[model samples]
Target: MKPFNTGHEELVHDVAYDFYGRRIATCSSDTTVKVFDRNDSTGEWDLSDSWKAHDASIIKVCWANPEFGKVLATCSHDSTIKVWEENIREKQNSGKRWKRVATITDHKGPIYDLAFSPSHCGLKLASISTDGQFKIHEALDPNAIGSWTNIFETNTLSSAPSRQLQSSFCLSWGKSRFSKEYVVACALEQSYIYQRQENGKYTQTGQLPAHGSIIRDISWAPSIGRGYQLIATACKDGFVRIFKIEEPVTEGGNLQVSLINQFDDHKGDVWRVSWNLTGTILSSAGDDGRVRLWKSTYNKEFQCVGIVSAEQKHDAIED
Candidate 1:
């Protein structure tokens, strides 16, 4: 594999690719975010823009749908989330520059992860924080820029108030175009599924006992009109687990969640898990510094298909 230096003074925390994979954005502990564009002719990536994005370490960056123009959302340890828009000027030398559109300061602690909804979900964004809060924001008008409304914010507690454990760490939106309200969040040792209500509020619909330790990452597979839902999660217990969510038949029914498969091949904390475009394969990485790919077999069992070890130290990789 070809390796490219990011030129960050500190460790890079996260990298995100645009919908088309034509542009790449990377955030770092250096409090900077850099964008890279892939050269169509030479097939090499070149730095397009670099700027200070936050006062503290930037944790994550996510790209919105191209239909909404070139937009990016970033979360930082400064307890803020910012949305940026790409502005193209007429002057040749000016080229393209990113401008901050909106800044959200609802979280009282460091924001761990942020994600934009699928294109079919309109312009919505979700963020999870160490303050034990989960928030959802929507663009007031999709045709208008920089106009966002704080839609919802609720405590990330699936258990009773007395049993509140640790801060919520990670969350993932279900990629089903048919269902826009499904999201899964993981805290200390449990993962809870939340579904948006008709009144624009979210309710805890289901819960999955994830791991003995903290969960680092979670990903929901894209359901292209599939009957069931699939979710993959990585945890500090050095394991990767997949769960299947089956909906009840009758109207306004509850969800049925079951563990489909799990892998303990990683010897250290598993940091991230992602599903392929078709939702057929899964990839995971962690402190072991190796990327493992798993696929389902004809017998309906999941098995490791391949492993890619980094030549040097690498933190995470996405599909």
Candidate 2:
């Protein structure tokens, strides 16, 4: 497959595939979003709609579950998250078909990343920012996309920063249907896991403990019927590490986390880490412009299975 150029005026920040992988959404420094549709008739992707999305560079874009219709959540350097929904009522202009439904102005600084919650959790979106904070917003009324409420917000670090910092803040939701409400967010060099309580609030539960450098990205693997939870992190120190968080014996108990493995094969800052649908394969992308795949053997040890060029978390703190 050849590389198809995304026609944006500035550098593209992020590219996200919709729920079914049939539609592609891209956000760019040009402060706009363009949707590409896979042309079933031609077996090629075509730019179907493009629209100005934010006041500043749009850094990340994500699609909601199909149960919510064609909805998109975008965050930007403008310090806000805007929700967009496709207007399907006999629309004539393709560009104007996607309308902004909610403008969330609850963050203090640039929002770097955002992810929608698992489908069972309803339409909740989690976001992390350079301000050292993470927030979760929910759509109260599915029909009225504009009805968004801030359900949870907390600083990633134990204390507020004394001054502004240059950090690649990011967050990932727990990707398991059977797990309790939880999210893992990272700020500078540390990452912490937060779990919701019975009283409608979230509290810090555990921490990932194997990094001396800042984290650039994070991904929580899907559990399915697995017994444990896995999280992969891309670190600025040129290593990719996976941690295992064992399920607690009781609800509201402390989660046990230990570093599973660390790979320095990238030899440069790793910027992205993701897991396959079954959580069996792990992929890491680094500053060296290479994507390496890691798969677990029958004995449960990870080995590099493949490497490709250019593909694919957060800050954590401790007491």
Candidate 3:
């Protein structure tokens, strides 16, 4: 992988990818989200299109409906999440370039992360903010332009009556094969599982340590069936911890969770951990500026996968 460093001399807050992994979106201190296209022929990503997304640093970008093609949602330090579409009409008709279509501004603080519900849910999306609130939006509205509806909100104070958990530095949704409502993971001192009930209320279903330091990221394991599925929590403690939810048949089917695995290979803070679509391979990146890969096995340890530093690797190879 090549670094498409812009030489902007600013820190990049986050990066996001479309479901297919062919397109990537990165929000930067430069206040813009740059979209890149991965050229399989050369194994290189080319800058395809860009949008001046925010007045301040752009914090995060999420694919709103990747299944529909060229649709995205981005959040920024400007306290807003905007839905954008790409019009590749010129590129499709003339076989040349892709472009961004629209930007819908809706939110109150820096949006840290977002997720579109599984493909089955269509254009629905959920976004979280540093203001300690999470919002769900339709992403697309035919009747009105740049319109959004807030379906859920979390209190900012840990002491609030509605606050089952405190501030969230991260968020993730569980995609279990059996369960219907999506399980939302809130990252903080005491993490919580917010399960959307049929009555339209989110109830705390479970809680975990969430993180040793701050939970920077969380990933849900691909579900198999009615059995227990796992979730990977990436900590600021330089490790990724995996946990499995077990429902005991004896205790009236109560759920029991246990830490199943941990990857303490990173020498620095582990910022994020993502599982491939198949849940077979795992990739992690962190403050060390290194990306490591892990696999599913009884080994119970994550090994060095790939490092992004070319000069460091070249020196090690030469030595």
Candidate 4:
């Protein structure tokens, strides 16, 4: 695989691709977010815009679905999350095409991760932070999408270690409009699922069980055609655990969850787990400096299918 340079003065924390993969957003500990657009003629990625989006290290950057226009959200150690928009992308103007549309600073601790809800879920943003806090903001006005309201907020800290030395908070939105709108977030060693209630409030419906170590990250796979939901979680125990969750068959039914698979191939703290667009394959990044891919076999058993390392001078390795 070919790599493009992201020129940052400090270590880059996250890189996100736009909905159509036409643009890339890279955020760094240097507190700047750079957007690179793919040049159709040259077949190269060119930096189209760069700006200081935060006063502290940017922990994560996520692109909103293109249906919401060219929007990007970044969370930082500044204890804030900013929503940016590039409304003038179709124009050739060289000046920064991106603008900060909204700034959310309701967190008492550094924000670690944020995700935009699926396009059908309306314009919503969910975030988790170091102080065991979680929040979901919605842009209710179709005319003025820049304005946001804090519709849901909660603190997950329950007598756990007050301070964390690493990035431990993360959240992901379930990609289905058929069921209730829900988000899964991690705090301390527990992962909780918050579902939107009939009262227009989100409440914790369930918690994933058997995770004893600190969960570093979590992802909810898109269950496009699947009958059930799959969630992958990476933890400090060096295991990437996959859980199969059954949707509520009846109104107000409880979620049925079972441990489907767990991989210890990382042999160290697994930092992140992400699913492909189709939700057929899963990828986990770890302290091993390698990314491992997992796929389900015909027997419904998950298997490690590939590995990619970022080490210098090392050729690619696969199984």
TM-scores for the candidates: 0.91, 0.92, 0.80, 0.93
lDDT string for model 2 (144-220, tens) is: 87988998888877765556654677889898878787799988888989987879788889988848788999999
Per-residue CA lDDT of model 4 for 148-167, tens digit only, reads: 99999998877545444544
Measured with C-alpha atoms, the lDDT of residue 90 in candidate 1 is 28
Q: Compared to the true structure, candidate 2 yields what TM-score?
A: 0.92
Global lDDT of each model?
0.84, 0.86, 0.65, 0.87
- In order of lDDT, best first, we have 4, 2, 1, 3
- How do the residues 1-319 of candidate 3 rate in per-residue lDDT, one tens digit apiece? 4556643347777778787788887778887777778888988887776656678887777775455666777677777666676666545223233343445456665667777767654356677666566666663553342555666666533542234543446666776546645555453544666666677666666666546776888887676533776777777778788777764465223356778778777777887888877666677777765666776655644444555544463423111
Pairs that clash in candidate 3: 79-109
Report how far residue 3 has shifted in candidate 1, in Å. 0.9
lDDT of 1 by residue, 1-319 (tens): 5578988999999999898888899999999888889988877888888889899999999999999998999999999999999876622223338889999887888888899988777799888877568888899698775877888787775543233644438888988877647888765667888888787777888888657788889999986657889999998888899998987776577789999898889988898999988888899997877899998898868998888777556633434
